[model samples]
Target: MKNNRLYAQFSTGYRAPQTTELFRLQAGQTIAELDAENINSIELGLRGQVESLFYDVTLFSMHKDNFIFQDTNRQNISNGETSHRGIELAINYQWQYFYVAANGTFAKHRYDTNLTLSRINIQDNEIDTAPEHIGSVQLGLRSDLGEFVELEWVHQGNCYINPENSSEYSGHNLLNLRTGIRLSERLDIGIRVSNLTDEDYAERDDFGFGSYRYFVGEPRTVYATVQYQY
Candidate 1:
């Protein structure tokens, strides 16, 4: 089409502190009435198609003020400022009944103002709970018999667990499979297997109260679902 296009956008935004941030009660903790966070963002994006292949990509940047974060003491606090940027890409190709698709994001979140946690200056450090990379890929077949099957791979990059960047949670890769069939004009059924390799990984980790802890990810599991339309 002659109208295929690329675009760029700029915007400013802000977020008021959430209820949890304003009123979470716990022993040894004090809640503060916090200011809303603000940000200025810019984005560039493209969408186009060539033959049987289609793709989209976006690049974006954000300058944030009063970024809400949890400190080493597990208290919700506003950080001075931060710079966030990322690239996101997605592509899909199809030839007849067979197709493949992938999408991913690579990002960076860094402190723009110096922070003192545990008596350490953490200016320009990677923020906790921020993964540098995350993505997924899939291959699948679609048939006229009202059925489809797909295999997928998912990934997450490592990230720090503390504002000081002293603790880490390693990255992980996982495999999954899904298949579905139409049982009738009004019914469908499906089956899924997640973490096909039964890989061991930590979903999250943190240091609190002078101790380090983690939540383990789920192991290999299978499940089924049925859907009926009225």
Candidate 2:
């Protein structure tokens, strides 16, 4: 699914705790009022498939009067943001013995931030880790070993940080294996492994960026399970 140049406008109001003393957020804080207004937004989408296995995509967008950064402690700063235009895609195939799939994301998200402070005003540009392009694929094969077994590979494209767009982040290629057996009537057992290759990669940047950056990913591991039903 996709969207384009859609705008959202809204207003909200709130009341602070009634206090005998002036509303004190910090030792020396200064905020205007408890009401907000004129917040705006927009979006766009482009996607399609080919031969029922291949795919294509694109995304364009812009927004104004948005404020996710106003959560700062300044108490007197209001900011708005927007996103850069981009695209993404994927492909896949499946057979009795072998199956594969691939996909990617391409987008440049940015925002304008401003703070209202006396002699300490601030404004800046922030580039998104969405990256102008993102891509990855997966391949899997099935086999017999007294039971049905399978192993698969997965990979992703790189990401980024900072408005200047530097230090292109690295992606991780992961592999997994699984096997199962019929233990008895309505009973089954299975074994599996994650991150089979144990490839070292950072799913996110040290600082907040893109979706869930700054979060460390997991390493390789193994597990076993059994299930019974009547």
Q: Write the per-residue lDDT of candidate 2 for residues 20-78, one digit (tens) a residue.
A: 22354444566434323233333343444444444434344444453423233445333
Off by over 4 Å in 1: 1-3, 23-33, 70-79
lDDT values for all models: 0.87, 0.53
Worst 10 residues of 1 by lDDT: 25-34
- C-alpha root-mean-square deviation, candidate 2: 7.6
- Top TM-score: which candidate number? 1
lDDT winner? 1
Candidate 2 clashes between residue pairs 3 or more apart in a chain or in different chains = 2-45, 3-44, 3-45, 4-44, 6-42, 127-163
Score candidate 2 by TM-score against the native: 0.58
Residue 224 of candidate 2: its Cα lDDT?
A: 94
TM, every model: 0.88, 0.58
